[model samples]
Target: MPSLHEFATWEPLLRLLRTGNAGNLAVPGGHVAGQISHYGWSLPLQRRIPRPGQAAQVEDVQDEFDAVQRVQGALADIGADTISFTAEISPTGRSVLHLISPGPAVEPGIGGPHPGSLILVEDSVPEPWRRLPDPVPGAVPAPSVDLASLERTLRERVPGAVGATEAEIAATEARLGVALPDELKVLYRVTRARWEDWGEDHAVAERVFTAVGCELFPLDDLYIADASSRPCPWRFGAREAVVTPPDAAVQGLVGSPGWIAFGDNGGGDRIAVDLTPGPRGHTGQIIMLSHEDNIGAGLLADSLSQLVLEGRGPGRRGRHGDGPPAVARVNIRSLDSVRAAAHAGLEVLSLGVWEGAPFSLAPVTGLPRLRTLTAYPGTLADPMEIAELTVLEFLELGPEDWRVLVDAGAVPRGLSAAAIEVHGSRHPLQVVALANELLTLWDRPPITRTIVEGHLEPGV
Candidate 1:
């Protein structure tokens, strides 16, 4: 097990990088950067052209594969997740490499050269994720619900199926801390749907799927699909808002504590019995949480009985309607300016890359609901204007913008989370310095960096 700091651990990878970026390394201030994990690498190496009349294969890039695998083996030995490196090679082939470890509390960047997010506040989550369904006082089961008919239908559909005992049902309720909906209990009473009951027979499982109208979970596998169950990174999650409309039959939420997940839609979506109904919804209506979406559910059926019998609902509609837009983006393609997106309803304001002049934040300074502001590096006319946004809970800014805020002692004390957005080839150490300053204000742990110095011989 070679040490990560040893020159041998990184020599092969560095040699490949030096060769691939030789042209750039000959010039002043030129460097090559990329990330590597146990799975693969994202280096700036040139791809070899396959000979005519042949398709590309792994063997074509064998050199790159072997180089990355050597580094991965060292990483596995050292128990590190991933490493990002920046290497600058002089024309004489003297190289300096800086290896960066994503310290605890930082989310790794997804499939790119970008550094991942820095979590400022520990265990803090976005407001929408923390939102609970508003109580629906007048909600009741739909008129179409019939417990006796549902039980009788299931019994006839799958004859001789083993059912869950009353004690088992009670044990499940105690495990989840919530009572099973009457409709779900009835379905499980007809067939517990455990694999052991049906043995290795594929036809029995198919019959259960046909009878239940969805892939049913065994009694022991039932879980509450709470907001915590569906996790999202703070950068994207902060931009979402839960807005259940007046006419919506299902409450728009990240997840509901009342959502008792009982089955799947066969495409990885969770089918749950929503106990916390919307203003116009029944208490036991069936809804689905899409695996692709971060927020909100779609109404599936009025009840479990309706789902198993008719296999459809009145209409499949999202829980949220065209309420006042809560998130606004100001960039080249989005709203032209801040003023155009200003309103009391706005909660998330993102300033992206722009072709026009930098914009001021004055238009939205006093808006009561604004809580998140993410500005691309140099998009703000005055970064100091962020101080006026007194209630911001999540703030993401480029290194320079954050420096301005940190230097003036105005890095929004109310922020529950923050991120440093880096563009181009800025050093990770510089980003860590800015992030530490922000974290220090909140008394959070600082990001630690490990520097490994090594040199590569000049490529022939």
Candidate 2:
């Protein structure tokens, strides 16, 4: 199975596979493109095709020491340039993380470095691919189509797709405060705010809607899928890689926006996407990003699967490999989308969103099959709607939103099987009430201190 980092790094390798060539190559992980990490190359300087179990060995100690020292110096010089690449045809990711030669390590023969021997250097803690740091203060936000423009296009262009009016968009933005990202803005303008809709040209409209194009390449067992139309082609660098069918078979495996689909390619490479929290079960599950649109539903799905895997109370965080379906955070905007995802064999969904956006409580009613629901700080209007889901086992409600749930008529009354955690919020009294209710209603209340601190507890 692939780790979160491996899954992302494989995009380049996967993109290479689309060319109909299956070969072994390493893709560095964590290092930015054009970054200078440890510098060294194959001695024979030839592309290697490692045979089954024929591990690439270190032939000379002096040459190896020289190479290792040089590589380390390069890393220190570049301030953390070691690269990690996922192999195009290897499943074990046996050597996914590697250091790229910053320059060249040429040690006069002690066994003039044999080919394929990796020289280790100072490995720096790689920073995550952070979204462009929140636009600098007073910076000009990228220009994008407004909600009105999107509404007009939808009304005048793709009349059949479901859409929100300009006023609705304003109301949502007003409720949230932060401006929508430019990528999202462009999508809304062209696709009427619906990310899933493939619009007029299944191919063309999808580009506008998804902000991703159809160019693909293969790397290891992963294929990097790119959206050509967008300015930032590297949607977080090689956005996604999969080993699924060509365009025709992709639809079958693409459950929603965040997840990608893949298929087996005979014997070239076996793919694995590991989102599981621990070491053992990690390889079997897929990793995903959460969204506010369907975050609630996504959470429910996650919690449901978690319950099945971990069981109640102390059993939730069990041993490494013996868990249920592995899940990650994701977003869900519409009930239809959530239902469709459910039908498509998606056992878990991850999401992050505001409280009052109708999602916090709506999933309880909208996504009947959801099991876990997680969220961040924000206000909420209603919470009573999801009071009766028996299957729900994990509820991660932020502190700010806890009070609304407590005040709502429904949440307290229908509480059952799951553990309800109130994250940081503004109201302590309310959190207490909610926690108290959980203790009273369920045999084992899932409330914890994190909830109180995130909301009521200060300096948290």
The clash numbers for all candidates, in the given order, read: 0, 68
Off by over 4 Å in 2: 1-349, 354-368, 377-381, 388-390, 399-402, 412-433, 443-460
Best by TM-score: 1
User: C-alpha displacement of 102 in model 1, angstroms?
Assistant: 2.5
Best by lDDT: 1
**Model 1, total clashes:** 0
Candidate 2 TM-score over all chains jointly: 0.22
Which portions of model 1 miss their true places by more than 4 Å?
Answer: 38-41, 46-55, 90-93, 313-315, 319-323, 457-460
